[model samples]
Target: MNIKRIEDTLNEFNKIGYSRHGMNRLAFTKEEEKVKRVLIELCEKEGMEARIDHCGNVIMIKEGKNPNLAPVIIGSHLDTVYNGGQYDGSVGVGVGVEIICSINDRNIQPERRVELICFVGEEASRFGMGTIGSSAMAGKFDQEVMSRLTDQEGVSFPKAVENVELDFETIRLASREGERIHAFFEVHIEQGPVLENHQKKIGVVTAIAAPTRLKVTIVGKASHSGTTPMNYRKDALLGASEIALTVEEAAKLEAVNGTVATVGQCSVFPGAMNVVPGRAEMKIDIRGTNVESKQVVVLKLLECFKDLKNRRHLDIQYEYLVDKAPVKLDTKMINSLSTTCEELGVPHLQMVSGAGHDAMNMASICPTGLLFIPCKEGLSHHKNEFASIEDIAIGAQVLEHEILKSM
Candidate 1:
């Protein structure tokens, strides 16, 4: 494979939808459609067969000597976070495609078929769902859960499926087919400064952290801010703020090996400067590779909320959005990746992924592995997200070597 050509390909991909800050290819939107089309075009250009699956997954096939063998799947989602950097999902898909192109260029044929997938709806910005496509493919989508989900526009989950030209009932049964999948591999950015801070080139992920998302609402009586004395007020916003702070403090106390908690979104009902908030709703995300520690943190948070409710006379309610267990990568696959990195002379480390990826869903069905390259300043899901061209090329080369070995 030509390193310069691969770098050029990445550059070309980054050029699409070049906003002043970053890219805007959110899931299930027109921009996402354009991105998938571009991927299909690239696959076709490389002489690979490409098609969109029932749930809008882009599957590009490279036939091997024996078509009967289950294909080795490699890919990541093409959808980005709102105003996210280009390399987050695009790099994984781009590198997977380049692997096919390089195989064709070298006239290499393997004994097992290779399929590159660009999964849809990996980000939860749309329809309040994450890994919808992959979860369906893995046979994990529950109709009861999906039917209750809604998008930003207040569109129901079934209506969203209709808009995408997919039958809801069929999608509910989408998981039975992926059982034949061989091994799945995904390459992605670290989305943190670990590699960059350590001056390393690659991160071979050992596990993907589980996320515990809680939606907490505190209710109090609304009163005039000016007229209500501080002693007489039971401010919901104040109670919510205390819980948020306690959550942050808990995460800080548990901050060994990438444990983190984030209050990503918060809202005050009747958001007026002159009125005390009657209700405050906030989304709290707690993540950790250690399940026990995560549970401890969550328990502490709930206890704090309970204490605040009893003391402040506020109504507190909690809704869980996510509580998935951490996924450990297949040891065999991790060993293969380690051997590949050593052969390629790339300095690498076995680390746990702090952020969620599509690999988490795939791990439930088959042996899975993930490759991580450094992101500038450990920053991802932002406009200023960046990964060096050199790092990108090296990551692709490592992936190419690993694919060859795996095949």
Candidate 2:
């Protein structure tokens, strides 16, 4: 395996989204398209057939000996969040390409074809609707879903498609069905410090939990900051703060399913130094591997909101942006990953994912597995995010060997 060559290709891919500070390949943009073209060029050099679907997903397939068998899919996104790292999604796509090329280099004919995909709009940085390519491919997309999505700049989904010079009507047709899919695999950076801290090279993900997002609004009457007594005044920002603490307490003490919660965004209305806050909006994100535990957290949160509204004489409202159940990956793939890592002398561990990935959506259509390599200090979605090429090569070798074994 030419680890250096693969790493070099990753570096070149990084330049496609090069920014002064970090990477900037937001989904469905021209920059992302260039990344697709670069991958297509790599596919052409390897004599693989490359195709792009309506949803702007790139798929390259290396035909195998038996034309009758289902293809095994291996892929990851190519788009990065704003000023993000290179290996976040490109690592998996690059490794898949390398595996297919390696097979062709050795002239080994396999029973099933190998496919590498670069899913478009996998990052929420573009439209806040991520996994568009994979969700469309898995037949999980609809007109209502697409119509409801809009970017921060007020660009709608269809409009963004036009901006990117892609066909939106064709996107409606980007669903896969009736085709045999052996399995789907994704190799990614751990995006966490667990692997690095544990001195493990590979992570065999057992499950990926779905997160529930809520946009909460707390309203109260504005009052004079210094004149109003604390006992008489209802501070909206203070109410939001109480809700945030309640959210954390519920997740930490009330949940038994490894639940976690975060208050990522908070904003106050009528910002002023002397004015008491009248309205506040906050974004809460909750995730867990166990379904019941997720429910418990939400229930407790709602109860607290009701109590706060009545006691503090305030108005509290929340809307869910994302709500879904946890997904358990393919048991066979998990076991196979373990065996492969051991056989290859790569240290590995079984764990569950706290973050979301395209693999979760892919699992809805086909058996899927996620393999993770360690990143530096578990930092991702940031400028300093990094992963060692050697670590990735190790994880990729195990992934490649496992895929070959299944064939």
Which pairs, if any, clash in model 1? 139-175, 192-378, 193-378
What is the TM-score of candidate 1? 0.92
**Candidate 1: misplaced stretches above 4 Å?**
11-18, 176-178, 226-229
Query: Count of backbone clashes for each model?
Result: 3, 2
lDDT of each: 0.84, 0.87
By summed lDDT, the worst window of 10 consecutive residues in model 2 runs over 170-179
What 10-residue stretch in candidate 1 is worst by lDDT? 172-181
**Can you write out model 1's per-residue Cα lDDT over 1-407, one digit (the tens) per residue?**
56677667666666666687677776677777777877888888877798776677888888889877877999898787777887888878878877888888878997888989999888887776788888887878888988898877888888876776778777755573445777898999899888988888989999999899999989998999999998888899999889889888899888885678999999998899999999999999999888887887899888988898788889999999889889888999999998899998999988999888889888888889899999999888888888876788788889888877877
**lDDT, model 2:** 0.87
Error (Å) of candidate 1 at residue 52 is: 2.2
TM-scores for candidates 1 onward, in order: 0.92, 0.96
lDDT (10s digit) by residue, model 2, range 155-187:
888998878777777776778855679999999
lDDT of 2 at 115: 88
